[model samples]
Target chain A: MLSDLYIPGASALHRMRPAWKLALLFLYCTALFVVSHSLMLGLGLLLIALGYGIAGLRPRHAFDAVRPALYVLVIIFAAQLWLEDLAMAAFVTLRLIALLMAAALVTYTTKASEFTDGILALLSRAPKWLPKDKIALAISLVWRFIPMIRDQFEEVREAQRARGIERSLLALVAPLVVRVLKSADEIAEAIEARSLD
Target chain B: MTTRDIVLIALFAALTAVMAVFPPVTLPLLPVPITAQSLGIMLAGGILGAKRGALSIILLLVLVAIGLPLLSGGRGGLSVFFGPTAGFLAGWVAAAFTIGWMTEKFWDGLSFVSATLICVAGGIVVMYALGIPGISLMADVPLSKAFMGSVTFIPGDIVKALIAAAVMVTVKKSYPIIGQAA
Candidate 1:
């Protein structure tokens, strides 16, 4: 369920430093809000889509990145359509899609290790006694276990469905918690054994 | 904190991220969709207590800050903070902390009903307190409209709170040490 957007490639975007990619993302997002016209936002979306092409990424990858936000985009579109004009609704939705795709491009190109290393380098400059190692490890593990926990969730969800507790949100809770906590314990023990502390 | 605390924090952070992968239930009237992520936040606090619970969410935010698509609908990056949902994103930390703090203060004598109540107060009440402003400011909507629009989230959130409460109670009964204070 954790859709890691990193599509491995040697594109220029991938070659760029993660920190710089982040800086540019901030710049792009700021630019998105500043440019208010529908035409400009539409052009912005086109420009971003072209960037995906230059990066040797498929248009489908960009679409997949923002796919999960389809519902939210529809909501934003309908909300603006109700509250304002068609032009404004299209402007807002296009901006959101452009922004999501831009961010996704960065994630799709950059490897997790490169991103984490960049983050660690930045965090290393923080004040002393910040528990930099622990924080770094926690962040790394967040990426590592996200996919695993996602798989576990699917397993638990299927089991719940099989037991005919499909509609009861409350019923799914206990087993999911138990499984996660059990894994947490095992992971803690493994950490101790490795003397990572 | 000890190894166990660090590990539990990471695990709960992962849990929070994983919860976002579940497809959100969108109510047409509200901008914010109903997500299981908030339930994970409640569980984090109720099960892990204040310090670790808040720290867990902090770690999750750190991942988001670095542009991991870990939120519901695969959202992340600095831009997300500039979006209408930023307040609710910020509220997750506070919500988790509030539930954890409540559990720490009252969970020694925790009851099924009280646990559910704590989740409601933190998960819904505190979440809205922060989120309404977020939507109002970022989305450029009126505060009154934002508040009214957000009322749709309550029914789903209430169900989530009950689930979180029941999960906590079950965990306490099944594996008591899991929630025992570090």
Candidate 2:
């Protein structure tokens, strides 16, 4: 569930280089803060909607991008209303929505590998002790292990549940950590055997 | 770092992400849901020691920056770096480092009480030192108001600290790894 975020598309946004898309996203977010007017933010939302459409994504995609942030946005909205005025509340909320949508659009279109490569390229100019290759390996390993660990957690939870254990943090985590560490040992040995380092 | 160290770091980073999969405990008054992911921060530092523990969190944040949706509620991307939570995100790295440092310092006679204190120092104290100001700046609220609002998270975070201390002690006895690793 980690890196399968790229939705298949043949649109211009999809075809654009990952680095450029990321840069533009950065610029858009910076500009969102610089321009405080709600009208401009509304226009920015329209542009993001147009972006989703141009990328052949549906309205649902835009909604999905903003949905995770709805709670925080609501809280901010309420806080702003209490602290300031109704207009300020709407402005702050709209600004965050615009930022989330623009950023989500890039992730929806860019492949994980392409994104990683783009990041690595950006880091290529860093000092030598950084160990770029090792960092890359670590990233790939993280991607590989996220789902595996999720599965392990579920399995452990199920086993514990069968034993009439429920909602015990130590009971759940103790076994999960042990199993995960055990697998980490095996993975390390495998990497050593292959001399992947 | 050794292969084992690298793998341990990656595995812990994965653990942190998996922690986010659990449903957050929400309070009606507060906007942020209390999530399990921060417990992973304490565990990493307590288990992996200072260097590798901090590296693992930095690695996770890097992935988040590139838009993996690894955070709770599937929120990620460059935008998160600019969000109200950005300071807490930065604090995670520092917190892990602090916890690891304290754990290693007390490894010779590490107790549950000491471990819990370490988690509280790093996870709650250090985290809020950065996070409160972040909320203050991003939400355009005063520092005092931000600090007042953040009081709700402390009890939950203390619970996390206690749980992390227990897990750390168990792991240390069952499969010691902090100083054992190359």
Candidate 3:
């Protein structure tokens, strides 16, 4: 859903290690929490965008990535307008967009396997008494499951539409729930077969 | 737990624990501040699905319920459950369920990015619904006010959702087998 905004390409940004990218991503996000403003944040956002461009992404691709979350951007904009002033709200909204875009740029270029491995490497740094393998497995599993959910959602939607149940949350939510439960079993079996146990 | 397993679990706990302690934010307009905790929820739900995700939260909540101050403000205890953010806190389970189910059902085509969107949609929407109402009732504020306060989170939440969804999609695109969601 969110990742589609990625400009499909290879570049220096894309070639960076996932661990390094994630660290940069984290630090960049943290910077947003601190002071987000005209030059600093704008420049930050711009650099990130430039990185995306250098990675061969077009304007349309960036738009596509943030398009899904547009509603959220609007809502937050509204909240800012309501709670504070138009200026503050606008500033915050722009800052957020920039930060998320930067983050997405990193995601857009990085490979999933490396991303998962990067997270696992991060997890392995924990003190004694933590389930590093499970955490890594969980991260990998979630990443793997994304496409499955999208595919199932379309199938269920089509199935429901065919059944003439238009816009029923049940039609959507129920199958989703069932499919998830079933997947769990399949995953466990796979894991067992692989002897991850 | 075996020595290695113990080491691994600690690692997982540490990630979440560190996140809990970081306490980053976008704004202070609302009393119930927005933190990266939702990202934690997304990660937990996206990665662990139901049982494991639920377990991760429970482990964190246990520390909170026992007065470990494991929440955003370093404030925790059973009392925290009754506070304004409780609904959002409690929403973690349902959110996980929603993400897990969505990812499980459609694990083949949607991509980890899209699955992340599902996870975040359920996680945040349900979280706020619960959090707002819980906060209203607990703080003696009008429900509408509580709802308004939550407005500040919409943009960030949406961004989080998109990121989660996008990441999921990308992953699924690469390793097709990772789709077993729930």
Give a tens-digit lDDT track for model 1, residues B102-174: 9878867887899999999999999899998976665555688678667767888987888898888888778
> Between the candidate structures 1 and 2, which one is better when assessed by lDDT?
2
How large a fraction of the reference contact set does each model reproduce? Answer: 0.46, 0.57, 0.00
Model 2 lDDT at residue A143: 89
| Tens-digit lDDT track of model 3 for B25-131 | 45445433455556556655565455455555655554344334345544443334432355777777667666666666666566555665686668777777677
Which runs of model 2 end up more than 4 angstroms from their true locations?
A: A1-3, A120-127, B23-34
- Collision pairs in model 2: none
Q: Top model by TM-score, which number?
A: 2
Worst 10 residues of 3 chain A by lDDT: A1-10
TM-score of each: 0.82, 0.91, 0.50
Clashes of each: 0, 0, 36
Better of 1 and 3 by lDDT: 1
Model 1 residue A175 distance off true place after TM-score fit, in angstroms: 3.2
- Among incorrect, acceptable, medium and high, the docking class of model 3 is incorrect
User: What's candidate 1's DockQ score?
Assistant: 0.46
Task: Report residue A29 deviation for candidate 2 (angstroms).
Answer: 1.7
Best by lDDT: 2
